[model samples]
Target: MGADVIERYVTDLGSRLQGSRRQVRDLLTETRDSLTDATEAHLDDGLTEAEAQERAVEEFGPVREIAHEYQAELAVAYGTRTLVWLAIVLPLMHMAWEYGRMLLIGPWQDFGTMPPAWYLFIAQANDLTSGIASGVALVALILGRILARKYDTRLLAKVGAGVAVVAVGTVLLGNISIILATAHLDAARLVQSAPMLVATLISWIVIIRFGLLARRCLSCATIVA
Candidate 1:
């Protein structure tokens, strides 16, 4: 029974190793094909299959190590892309929907019939804060992309720190603005503004998630390097 168990464990490990090897091989092949095509176009020089294979393998470093690195990098890229899209599209849609509701149903329907000046001030503050946060998140996503490409650990850490700070600051500012606006308005109006609060919370979560992803990617890079 012990021998059988040992055999089964070894078999499972062998299968996993085979799957990993195949994945790494596919990635290496794609990388090599792209590079070879570009090199041929730029230099009008073609490499033999053996030469190209050797060069690609050399550039990719150790196969096992690079496979692990690629896994982390791909995860970070996927997460960052999701966060970027959410940051860019969600806030704008929220603001537009809020404004549309106010326009159609009147400010009282939404904001409890506040003075026009107060309405405008609140709207402006909301838009400004949302825009700033989205912009910062977008910038951080871009920086994360750049750092991922370069595998720059230090820069990734810096970008993550900046994102965390901006996300926290935006949340604080948004909460304060909402409180101040609602103080002069009815409690019911504050409750009506829950959508904005929810959106802000979602944005905060996305920012924090992506920031953590960046930091984790950087940490993995440090280990690999």
Candidate 2:
């Protein structure tokens, strides 16, 4: 009977929250651990098993209130994870693509020197895309940590998600602009070889992965009911 109460409470709490699977599992595990410890302490104090469990549940607080707190934590965790990916993975992917290009194709011909000014502008923007995105993500993360307690978790989560989306969007647009410009100038450079094609595919995949994570952050934040 006591076990049933705990199981029921955990199930209900789990049902109320949504986010990364690993995060939800971890929080639920902690909930079980704390409740178990409380029950054991009550038992040591000489209460019957059922009575001890009942006492434990009471002290643990109502499930609805606990679920609200857990959901907030889940939202924050999801947002932080998205920010870290933006900070680290985006820049790395950009670097990898640049290095791959250099290895796969030698420096451009006179095109490198005499590309049209608009093309040059787009190329420079593409070069800075990842760095700018990563910098914004890092700043947002630091600010989030500083203001975490003062602001609501859901708001922080939504803000983090928005930043992530904008960052990724910037990178994506930069890449597209560079590619389109390159295609217009010399389509051959766009697909130098099979290896370059594969590298480009991988870069796109990484960007899509980050975009999905950012989307999930918003989903987790908005599900406040």
Candidate 3:
């Protein structure tokens, strides 16, 4: 009888959450343990089994209320994961692409038809953008840990999601600008090297993957009511 009530409550609570599978499972397990403990306490006080479970569920608060609280924590966890990915992957992707170019095609100076000053400036700026975005992600991640207990979970989640989106967007913006500038100046340069083209494609795929992550992070943060 008590198991039925606990099952119903846990299922309802689980339905409202969206996040890392391990995180969600851990929270649900903890909820079950708490409810079981509460029910046992009620039973020790002489309440019937059914009465104990009902009381435990009541004490756990309304399903919606509890779910909202859990959702906030889950959102924060999701944001943290996304930030970590951004911090580590962004710089590595940038470096890998740069190194692949240097190895496969030598320096840009090796090309007979050198690109103009504006193209070089754009390339340099794009490199700097990736570094800056990675730095921002690292700072946000560190501050998130430091302020975990100091700030509201929802606020932290929103801020983290926003940072992730902006960081990804900055990297993507730099890539697009450089691509367009290169295409306009010398379209042949874009596809001259098969190896570089593959590297560029991989870079674009990484950017798109993180863009989706940022979108989902924002979605998770937004639904924390």
Best by TM-score: 3
Global lDDT of each candidate: 0.52, 0.84, 0.89
lDDT-better candidate, 2 vs 3: 3
Candidate 1 is scored at a TM of 0.45
Top candidate by lDDT: 3
Residue range 88-191, candidate 1, lDDT tens digits: 76466557656755654455534344456765677677667656767777777777768756866334434544464555466456656766776665455544
lDDT of 3 by residue, 86-113 (tens): 8898899999999988998788789877
TM-score of 2: 0.83
Native-referenced Cα lDDT, model 1: 0.52
Q: What ordering of candidates by TM-score runs from best to worst?
A: 3, 2, 1
Which runs of model 3 end up more than 4 angstroms from their true locations? 1-3, 44-46
Scanning candidate 3 in windows of ten residues, the lowest lDDT window is 148-157
Q: What's model 1's lDDT at 36?
A: 54
Candidate 2 stretches with Cα past 4 Å from truth are 41-55, 110-114, 149-156
Question: For every model in order, what is the number of clashing pairs?
Answer: 0, 0, 0
TM-score against truth, every candidate: 0.45, 0.83, 0.88
State candidate 3's TM-score. Answer: 0.88
Better of 1 and 3 by TM-score: 3
